[model samples]
Target: MKITLPGSKETLPVGKILCIGRNYAKHAAEMQSDVPGEPMVFLKPSTAIVRSGGVVVLPKQSKDVHHEVELVAVIGKGGRNIPEDEALHHVSAYAAGLDMTARDIQSKAKANRHPWSVAKGFDTFAPLGPLTPADQVGDPQQMEVSVTVNEETRQNGRTADMIFSVAYLVHYTSTIFTLEPGDLIYTGTPDGVGPVEDGDVAEARVSGCAPLRVRMSRELD
Candidate 1:
């Protein structure tokens, strides 16, 4: 999938979606999960991206689906083993993002110790807003990130609650996978993650970035 940045129509080819799990203590507690000593990483292919204001067509295979609001960092430069101090230099832009999941499927996968590809990597599962240039967004750690379902606030928290900072995530992820332009890092979600049903409107907002709005639809059997 190709995504366009703010003030520029030129599309950037999406390479991959790197997601961090349980990065917030409250969220971890809500999920009954332990906070990891280091970042818990997962990958979602480009096909999972749903453009801003698009529809999130729910997969028929699962009954419980969830929305995770996050701050997304878009990579501008590629590098490996990057220093934390230099990590932000690799960022081109930031955006509000939603990490959608088939909760039932994810739970089953966890029980079997299987990969999360089937549960978290479905089409229309990753929704993102317009990208705001890095220079425009200062101190990402202080930004407010939130999600609303049907106009009722659900997830609300500041980036300050992140267990692992954005720069650290970039540096850590680059060490395992070669960071590349257009690669997106979802910096994890806060507490209050819950189910989304058909016709529900999910909106995600990151301070200083365009709000990402999506309508949920169930695939007709």
Candidate 2:
């Protein structure tokens, strides 16, 4: 294999992937989900991660799939019970990401009252990339996040619609679990989510942040 670009010695982050769900009421209703009272947090194993411009393999167990474009907050420091006013102090940077879901499995699990791991934690389910240093994101609250599958826009959400703000997310999540260096917080997705087929090229972006894109493939039998 030939390397085209110089690879930096910078080591990739290894930390918790905390994802919030249904923060936008319109998004929840699109799937007929209820508007939750608080942040619906879930974990994506570090192994599920793929960098920007990487391929996202559709899990074998799923049928219907969906993409949830969101704002990603990368933590620079560790702390618990951090106040909302000071939460930004812990942030390292921001980026765009996707909470790719196995919709069929997720719906089934919901009916069975089961945990969301199987539906949300499969390999390549959390696609993120193009790291932007924290100092660069000027206004995290006003960014635009969008997703497109096969050149068709599926989701377009602005951070302003969030019922619970980013500051509150950090303030709340840290109080429960100590957020350490490299911990990533996926704020949540907006409305308008649907499926992608094999060979579909999906592209997502958080305006003024990072770009999130993936090539879809299925494991051959």
Candidate 2 residue-wise lDDT, 132-152, digit = tens = 766677778888889989888
Cα distance off (Å), candidate 1, residue 189 = 0.3
The residue-by-residue lDDT of candidate 1 on 1-221, one tens digit each, is: 89775556778899879999999999999999999999999999899998787999899998999999999999988999999999999998999999998999999999999998899998999998888999899998999999999999999999999999999999999999999888999999999999999999998999998899999999989
> After TM-score superposition, what is the CA distance of residue 94 in candidate 2 from its true location, in Å?
0.7
Candidate with maximal TM-score:
1
The lDDT leader among the candidates is 1
What's the count of clashing pairs in each model shown?
0, 0
Q: Please, what is the TM-score per model?
A: 0.97, 0.93
Instruction: Show model 2 residue runs off by greater than 4 Å.
Output: 1-12
Native RMSD of candidate 1 (Å): 1.1
Model 1 stretches astray by more than 4 angstroms: 5-9
